[model samples]
Target: MFISLNVKFDLFYSILAPNVIPDGFVDGRQVTEKLLEATQLDKNLYQCGNTKVFFKAGTLAHLEDLRDDKLNGIISLFQAEIRGYLMRKQYKKLQDQRVALTLMQRNIRKYLVLRNWPWWRLYTKVKPMLNIARQEEEMKKAAEELAKLKEEFEKLEKLKKELEEQNVTVLQQKNDLFLQLQTEQDSLADAEEKISKLVLQRGDMEQRIKELEERLADEEDQAANLNEVKKKMSSEIEELKKDVEDLESSLQKAEQEKQTKDNQIRTLQAEMAQQDETIGKLNKDKKNLEEQNKRTQEALQAEEDKVNHLNKLKAKLESTLDEVSLWTKWIFFNIFHSLL
Candidate 1:
């Protein structure tokens, strides 16, 4: 191929080589030179001239093959970019569709469950009574109120247990206080009769407490029923409140104990007229027990108030809970500490 491409050859020396040249500098000869350089072919196969090039016939075919391969690759790259963009756009739309369907399914399920409950039926019926034209998002208000009521009912159940235990403690405390009063007022017939009556009343209270404890298990089941918890819980709470009121009745023994102490004081004063020191000491003891009993009565009354205001007590149990907790612990405190 090299020996065949010399200017001495008729093809190279022909008028055709000068015909393929530049700008006239960029015409046939320049195009031919660039193509020849890209192929790194034997230079003898072609000759460039001032205005033209001369080449063997098959040389132009090599340039044609390179051009076709380059155009096909660029077109393929453009097609791949467009295909990727379309696939990503379609995938994003599909993901959004799936998410929307999931949310719709979730919310609809919640609404259906809430609507099917017995509480929901009762709420829908009685909504008018509360003037429940739902606003300020009143449904939200109703839901909050429902949660608050449930919390109160739970606290009441706990309080009922505490008060029952504390009731026994209070009764036992009263018994001890009166026993002291009995010792001091032993000579008085009136004091003796009253103390005997209180003892009988305490026996009746113990029997009543036993019956209430047996009833506790049954009521506990009713309180736990979620479907009827709202309406039935309120009715159940009212009955428990009555039981608490009966608990309050037991503390009346305190007032009777007060009378017994007063009588003892007077009898001590008259009998120990010369022994002024013993009289003063007995009087001092009476005053301390009175103060303690007064505070105890007030605390029980406050517990009753908390029972009534269980709804109002969102968080503030304050010292009342502390005192209530101590009620059981200090059950023996009065028996020993007060005597000492």
Candidate 2:
């Protein structure tokens, strides 16, 4: 078998070319020793025709040349070695891709499943609370508006009542003035008839005429006092007219205020209704967000369970690899001793 190995040694030598041969390999101990020594010098080396050669790490040129050999055994080993190296390289690439993919998958899964979990909870709980706060603010504003409207309405009502009361008072004063004017005119006519009767009596007696003259002077003084009273009444009538005009102006102002208050109440009622509708919509949206939060929670739980299961599988795989390594070492030791 060793001589047959030398038959196509040139092919192997080229494939397993050594960069530096070891100092003590001039006399070979065994095939395995020579192979081990050649590998130590250059791990890419392969054996053929009692020599070693190196091939590039990923090239198949040497293996292709060896395939032309008619002997199946020699060709088989060369093919096996090339296939093993390629398989190992391919496996390593797959492992790297798997590791990268696993990390990427884990990160993607985490973000997809867990990243929004807290955000969902915040949206569910905090959004509703914010909505409630906003609704409360709106309610407060509505209440303030209602209060302002009611206050203005009350003020306008009070002012209107006051104006009506003032108008009634002015009318009463005018009626009193008319009654006083009638009484004054009746007194003036009675005084005129009494003075004419006094004049006729004065001509009847000389002594009586002297007394009558003094009485006439007293009557003239009373007429002068009446004229002064009439002048004062005329000034009072003018002052009452001014008061009536002022009352009319106040009545107009009160009516305008009442109209403004009515408008304000209408506006407040409209705004309050709008706020109620907005609050209802916000409440509905809050409910929907809460349902979404529940679904997110369930999804996060499922992802956590999957990650835990994967961790267990990875631990089991590591344990199996350890066992395989120990078995391989035992087999290698046995084979080495048997060869010795």
Q: Which stretches of candidate 2 lie over 4 Å from their true place?
A: 1-227, 324-340
For 74-176, candidate 1 gives per-residue lDDT tens digits of 7899999999999999999999999999999998998798987978755654443333233324445545655565565555555555545554554455445
The TM-score obtained by model 2 is 0.30
Compose the digit string of candidate 2's lDDT tens values, residues 1-340: 1323322333344334344334221222244345435434444443332222334543335344433443476679899999999999999999999999999999898767764686664444333433444545554655555555556555555555555555555545544543443343345445445545544443333344355456556656778766665555556555555554555555455555545545554554454455455545555555555555455555555545555555565465456556656766897999999999
Candidate 2 lDDT for residue 213: 51
What value of lDDT does candidate 1 attain over all alpha carbons? 0.54
Measured on C-alpha atoms, candidate 2 has an lDDT of 0.51
**Model 1 off-target regions past 4 Å?**
1-32, 114-340
Q: What are the clashing pairs of model 2?
A: 9-48, 9-49, 15-53, 16-46, 16-52, 16-53, 16-54, 17-53, 17-54
lDDT for every model? 0.54, 0.51
RMSD per prediction, one decimal?
A: 59.5, 52.7
